[model samples]
Target: NQRVLVTLNGHPLRRGLLPRADGSRYLLFGQLVCRRLGLRVGDTLRVTLAPDPNPDQVDLPEELAEGLEAWPEAAAGFARLTPGRQRGIAYRVDSAKRAETRLQRAMQELEQLARMG
Candidate 1:
């Protein structure tokens, strides 16, 4: 698995290039990107890729950070998770359009993390 910056028809995306057993590589696009780009399976694309400069970087939303700060055990559990999992949680929280919703999602993630401890 290699983290990469991909451009599909001029749209920028951060993703990983996963390898198959046969040694071929492919990128997985999220539905949001697919819908935004009006893409369907098998659609041809103008693609370009490069190694991600900051592959391990995940943008931690303020609400999620605060939740982690208030729950030490949950924070520890979160730290134990894989980078992909942590990024997923942060993405979920950040995807919420409203502040209250983001806070709610952050709390929910904290609760789940707490249970994992």
Candidate 2:
């Protein structure tokens, strides 16, 4: 795996859900590093956070539609958020270990965001 260097010129930071080989999910926070970056589903990446940070090889995880669809309220709240914010929340939830924990956290996030008005 090669190190993915994130520089100041990276465009459009985005986060999304990816799938693991074991059928688990991971939240990927990545940038469009290069036109040659060549990203596809089920790709492994070596990413470095900064100049001094240790590089880690991470696998991309995919979103499970049933998991996301199970929480209709959270989905609605997610839709109401700015795209970046929604990505942030989705990334965080996808990072949870257990399905129940992810759902609970998503519900809490949605409730809190809804109360922000």
Highest lDDT model number: 1
Tell me the deviation in Å of residue 71 in model 1.
7.2
The C-alpha lDDT values of all candidates are: 0.87, 0.49
TM-score of candidate 1 versus the correct structure, residues matched by position: 0.63
Q: In candidate 2, residue 30 scores what lDDT?
A: 44
Residue 53 of model 2: what lDDT? 36
Q: How far out, in Å, is residue 89 in model 2?
A: 0.5
Question: Mind giving the per-residue lDDT tens digits that candidate 2 earns over 3-117?
Answer: 3334323432332335789977554444433323656656665542333233332222234234336666545655566645654566576677677877677666766655553
Tens-digit lDDT string for candidate 1 (1-117): 699988999988778898999999988877757777899999999999999999987668899988888899899989899889988999899778688999899999999999886
Model 1 residue 66 distance off true place after TM-score fit, in angstroms: 6.8
Model 2: residues >4 Å from true position, as ranges?
1-77
TM-score of each: 0.63, 0.36
Return the lDDT, model 1, position 42: 90
Q: List the residue pairs that clash in candidate 2.
A: 18-61, 18-62, 19-61, 19-62
